[model samples]
Target chain A: MATFMDVHRGMTGITDEQLREAHAADLAIQDEEGVSFEHAWADPDSGVVYCLSEAPSPDAVQRVHERAGHPASEIHPVPLAV
Target chain B: MATFMDVHRGMTGITDEQLREAHAADLAIQDEEGVSFEHAWADPDSGVVYCLSEAPSPDAVQRVHERAGHPASEIHPVPLAV
Candidate 1:
């Protein structure tokens, strides 16, 4: 498995409750795709949200996010980290 | 304090050792700005690097990366997370 950082754009005015709810949604169905949505951060002002996860592939991470209601605009594989 | 996600572009052939070394450099000086370089991810294929940090502002994050020798191209403040 590889870690990935996915970015979701155009999420302006996103509330903390909404962000948590969306994360919970991903967590609920991520297992089906062999993905784990570990954490997420958002800059409502920029209309951008970033999700960090571990998955078999970038597709798996996108699948989870798409299924959970917010499709990511960019999915970058994080093969190396520190 | 706010969490920030900074992106560095055009590091096409960055190796794991280089990534670690850069991160260590940031760590060595992060406290000077009251910033914490929590984690970093890189996609060598895409020539992109992402750093996650807690700092007073995006400028602080940028300063650390600049002094560490890998200034980020973009820095976004993540005021909300889950």
Candidate 2:
């Protein structure tokens, strides 16, 4: 089993290019920490981003995010009924 | 092993009481159709609701929503990395 973190973004202050850069930095941080980001999506209007990831625990997710300099807004446990 | 659908809601046209009623009705519709609603959450500000359900097919999810008289705004397939 793994824990996932849903990271929200404040897109109003950041440009699209900046967001991509941040995502790249975060991806590297997560990859180094052995966290697999299953999927991530952004709402253009809301500027919120939801990330689905597989990590040993929620703390690991936070560690990677902290290293990336963008901590998550909320983390939710994803337990699949399947 | 199963397909999951994320159902979105619109809160502007409805009240809290109305939303609860709709949820109850949707829950019943989904339950009768063999879809297990594993979890659900709502955002008070946006009036958007997200429902996670384990269903055999995406069409099954739509069927329940249609029966409940509130088809989802968007349904995304959830695949757990765990």
Candidate 3:
């Protein structure tokens, strides 16, 4: 399994409720894109949201963000500490 | 591919260098267990280290921690915002 953490910066204005709303809809998005969204979190002060997911390719991860209308700032490859 | 975020607490006294040292050793440990680690971060104040990784089972993830001398506090599947 390929595991990764994608973090986004400059989310200062977004609220957890708003993001959570987005997350509620995100399931369908993931289902449609063939990706599994495991969890998502945002720092209230820092305006950063971290997302973890499973996908065959990184492009699929990006596609989900694009469709959601919130462009990600840093979609880094988070190597798990196994 | 399945992504997960494992957060461990009670590390209040550990330093970044100390954790980084462990992380450096983690690669070889991962290779032996057939797990791939994407990244790890430690909170100096909170003593919490969050790790992201790819593995076939949750037990595999725990095995790495046991061998490393630090057990994980929480292992949650991170749903991707696809």
Per-residue CA lDDT of candidate 2, range A4-73, in tens?
6464656434445656666677788777778877655554444556666788787787788778787888
Model 3 misplaced stretches (Cα beyond 4 Å): A1-82
lDDT of 2 by residue, B4-78 (tens): 546465654445566667677878877777877665555544455566677877777878878988777876554
Model 2 compared with the native: what TM-score?
Answer: 0.49
> C-alpha displacement of B36 in model 1, angstroms?
1.2
Tens digits of per-residue lDDT for model 3 on B13-70?
6675777777766666987777787778665554667777877666787888879887
**Which ranking of candidates, highest lDDT first?**
1, 3, 2
Cα deviation at B48, candidate 1, in Å, is 1.2
lDDT of each: 0.92, 0.63, 0.68
| Fnat of each candidate | 0.84, 0.00, 0.07
Task: Write model 3 residue lDDT over A1-82, tens digit each, in one string.
Answer: 4555566667766675777876766666877767777777665454667777777666777788778866566554433333
Output the number of the DockQ-best candidate.
Answer: 1
* Docking quality level of the chain pair in candidate 2: incorrect
Model 2 — interface RMS deviation? Answer: 9.6
**Better by TM-score, candidate 3 or 2:** 3
Q: Return the clash pairs for model 2, or none.
A: none
What's the candidate order when arranged by decreasing TM-score?
A: 1, 3, 2
> TM-score, each model?
0.95, 0.49, 0.52
